[model samples]
Target: MSDTDKKTVIVFTDGACSGNPGPGGWGALLQWNGQEKEITGGAPDTTNNRMEMRAVIEALNALNQPCHVKIHSDSALIVNAFKQGWVDGWLKRGWKKTNKKPVENRDLWEEMLTAMQPHDVEWIKVKGHSDNERNNRVDRLAVEASRKFQQS
Candidate 1:
């Protein structure tokens, strides 16, 4: 591909959990032009949503510039938060729910926004276990990471 035709960046991310509050893992695949990179990590005790947020945060942090980015994920919670503008509303309200309770995962949400500030991002939701090869790969990597954490 010519320089002008090269894709700036594309990322696929997923998170896996052995249990809601058990071992968790996050996986991310970053692609730019003809290059591919993968990142994965796990926590001994955590929630799936935290892992999901971490995947995006780490993926964005991997980039050195404010390049255009496309992010693919299977987590409805993450996808809808951005798509429906819920995240903006949450931040505007100081990360509080309508009922006055603190929003869950606020720290990660804020971190993700900060990491994303330099990029023009487009979030796309992909069906899990479908034909998207990259997404599936990240999903499996997340599960593997989770298993490794559990074993440790």
Candidate 2:
């Protein structure tokens, strides 16, 4: 949290997929000053992690101004990437993994980094399929969105 003056925004995000590389969707819910907004998007063919990251990317992009953000998500991979310094290491290595393999979802990773630049960001990992209401809502939103692609 860099700026104390920035308004605090709480966000819940989730992603869903019908198949590993099939129809996928991502959802986000943003809350600020007693108001809330929901956003969702779907891809015809994608991975679950990419959809997960997309939820974060879209949520951050929704902010019109720089703010302190707390993002609650069920994805440990996304949370740990930021909280555990994986993003920094990946950057230092030109987006390569420790084994020198190219990182998966590099495009979304780049966009997420850019969308995050204006905010003081905190990633919170939440338990999936648990009792978190907002998280569950976003999950349903993601699943519902992906259902459209599932039929096609």
Candidate 2, residues 1-152: lDDT per residue as tens digits? 44978999999999999999999999999999999999999999998998999999999999999999999999999999999999899999999999999989899999999999999998899999999999999999999989988865
Indicate which candidate wins on TM-score.
Answer: 2
| Model 2 ranges with Cα > 4 A deviation | none
Candidate 1: where are CA atoms >4 Å away? 1-7
- Cα RMSD for predicted model 2: 1.4
List clashing residue pairs in candidate 2: none
> What's every prediction's RMSD, in angstroms?
3.1, 1.4
lDDT of each residue in 1-152, candidate 1, tens digit only: 33344347999999999999999999999998799999999899999999999999999999976777899999999999999998888888999866778899888998999998878788999999899999999999899989988864
Q: After superposition, how far is residue 131 of candidate 2 from its true place, in Å?
A: 0.5
TM-score of each: 0.91, 0.97
